[model samples]
Target: MLTFFALVHQEDDSAYGVQFPDVAGCFSAADDMEQVIRNASEALALHLEDGDLPAPRSLAEIKKDEDVAAELAHGAFLIAVPLISFTGRSKKANITMDAGLLQAIDDTASARDLTRSAYLASLARRDISG
Candidate 1:
């Protein structure tokens, strides 16, 4: 899971526009406020197709930049967009955990019709995004 900071702006009577600072030439737009995040996510996915994603900078670090600071001084704002890039391949790994926690994870996964790995991955995604 990866997260990117997007600069968002909207002019009077215009659609909202979003751009990723770290990803040059990648952008998206939506007429409604509610659709901004979804549109931006799709735009990022399409732009990054078969391309390596650059690591995201911390919010503090990003805000320190002159251009971003100028945008913030105006009406523009920052939004965190989670980017989950799946390579269409899976790899196995091993880990250690407490027995009680493992049992609880198994029970929850069974109730949700998900495997332990799936459940854990979902949890990680939610945690990072949230």
Candidate 2:
């Protein structure tokens, strides 16, 4: 997973605002702190879905910018947002696992009307993003 840094700002009576310094035109807002990471992750995924992804800079690099410095001085903060990319392609993989665990996974996937692969992918995405 690749991660990008987001600059977050909030006023006394408004929702929290977020912007990706490395990704132009990508932004998100959340009503509270709990939503910040999730909302930012979704916004970043959508923004890059149809475009080339930009290289993410480090915190030290972003902090060096004069504009970012000013923002930080004015109560803005930074957060790391993880990016999960999907290429719309699949490849075969062979793995060894305990038979009991495999059976449980298959049964749960069947109950949810999802394939084993899809269920595993969803779990990975949720864990990585949150």
Candidate 3:
């Protein structure tokens, strides 16, 4: 699933309501900030599951919350939330292999009736996790 950053602002003087601009119809609020954050998580989860928002960022985006919130006081607080990027992480890691590693991979793939890439991927899962 993808995630997206949103600028949720208070829409009224009472500050009881919040609205996510980047996300249409995505509004979550509570009597307090704690509840608001929890509700926002649920709302964000639903929004992402519904595939309404864009892909989220791996790294947190820079935003000015206090100033933006003041600017949007008539609405909701302008918050910079770290969203889950559906595209996943972009960082790369280096791995070492022997000269005959490719040949061994081919042999394993053929034995399992799988592609070399698939075999390697499974190997990676096992090696990394188990």
Candidate 4:
């Protein structure tokens, strides 16, 4: 699963917080940035579940949002989150390949001008969507 990073800025007073970009809505204090992040994630997850996804605006659009600028001026930390990637992250998974298979993977790597590890990784993710 591909997860994006979320940067958070916490206020010393813990009163009134703001989220990054124009994507996540601004948050009022009563909670710290961590709480804000948690809430934002929950809200995002709920939105995704309901299929009420927001159109992903480019970074430029985000830069032009006055609300975002105001929030940033308040020392809000940039927090990136894996909105689309969360669904595929399984809590636990294990893969066991036999030695012969490993060797075959290495051979395939040699044939493809890629390292064995790279070959195995590509094999694992051959069908993954971008």
Candidate 5:
């Protein structure tokens, strides 16, 4: 897993803006803080979809940059965003779990009109990103 540091800024009446110093031209925005991490991850994935992945700088290194330091001096902040890679391929997996839990998962998946695999994958993605 690769994690990149995102610089976030918000003015008095605007949405939160995100920028990745390591990946040029990759950015994201969210109306609130709760969506920042998820939006940043999606933006990064889309930005690198057809390009080579850039190596991420360590948190220490990023915090040392003059521009980043200046931003931090202001009200801006930083967040670690995980980059989840997708290969566009699927393979079957066999696993064991409690029957009752499996039934609940099935019910939830059905209610959301998603397959069991899809629901599980969504949960995994959220967990990994957070």
Candidate 6:
């Protein structure tokens, strides 16, 4: 898991706009505040899908940037956006849980057309990001 600092801008009567300073050219937009993080995460994932991603800069470093400083001066704000990598490799693990609970998880996953591991991973990502 990695996290990026996204600068958000909202002009009068306009949608919220997000741009990742660490990942150049990566951005997203949303009409509602609640969608900003989710949309930004998706944009970051797509933007990083191809090659090696550069290391994320620290907040202090980003804040020191002249461009970022200018944006901050104009009312833009920052938000932390979590990046989850889908490695496409499977790993096996052993855990103990109540049999009924396990069965329920499996049933729910099946209903959603996802494997148990995928369902659990999604839940973990959401919890961690939130």
- Candidate 1 TM-score over all chains jointly: 0.66
For residue 109, model 1's alpha carbon misses the true position, in angstroms, by: 21
What TM-score, over all chains together, does every model reach? 0.66, 0.76, 0.40, 0.43, 0.94, 0.79
**lDDT of each residue in 26-130, candidate 1, tens digit only:** 999989877787778768877897788787899998899899999989899999988866567888989899999999999999999999999998777555444
Q: How does each model score on lDDT?
A: 0.86, 0.91, 0.54, 0.52, 0.93, 0.88
Q: Give the Cα error of residue 126 in candidate 1, in Å.
A: 12
Ranking by lDDT: 5, 2, 6, 1, 3, 4
TM-score, cand. 3: 0.40
Over 4 Å off, model 2: 11-15, 31-35
Better structure of 3 and 6 per TM-score = 6
Backbone clashes in each candidate structure, one number apiece? 0, 0, 7, 5, 0, 0
Ten-residue stretch with the least lDDT total in model 1: 121-130
**Per-residue lDDT of 75 in model 3:** 48
The order of the candidates by TM-score, greatest first, is 5, 6, 2, 1, 4, 3
> RMSD of candidate 4 to the true fold?
11.0
Q: How well is each residue in 20-88 modelled by candidate 2, as lDDT tens digits? A: 999999999999988898889989999999999899999899999888899999999999999977678
Off by over 4 Å in 6: 110-113
Which residue pairs does candidate 3 place in steric collision? Answer: 9-75, 9-76, 9-77, 10-75, 10-76, 10-77, 11-75
Supply the global lDDT for candidate 3.
Answer: 0.54
Cα lDDT for residue 117, candidate 1: 95
On residues 1-130, what C-alpha lDDT tens digit does candidate 6 reach at each position? 7889989999999999999889988989999888888888878888998868889888999899888889999999988888876677888998899999999999999999999999998887666555
Which tens-of-lDDT digit does each residue in 25-114 have in candidate 4?
A: 533332644355455554445445645455655556665667666666877555554453345444544668899987888888999999
The best candidate in terms of lDDT: 5
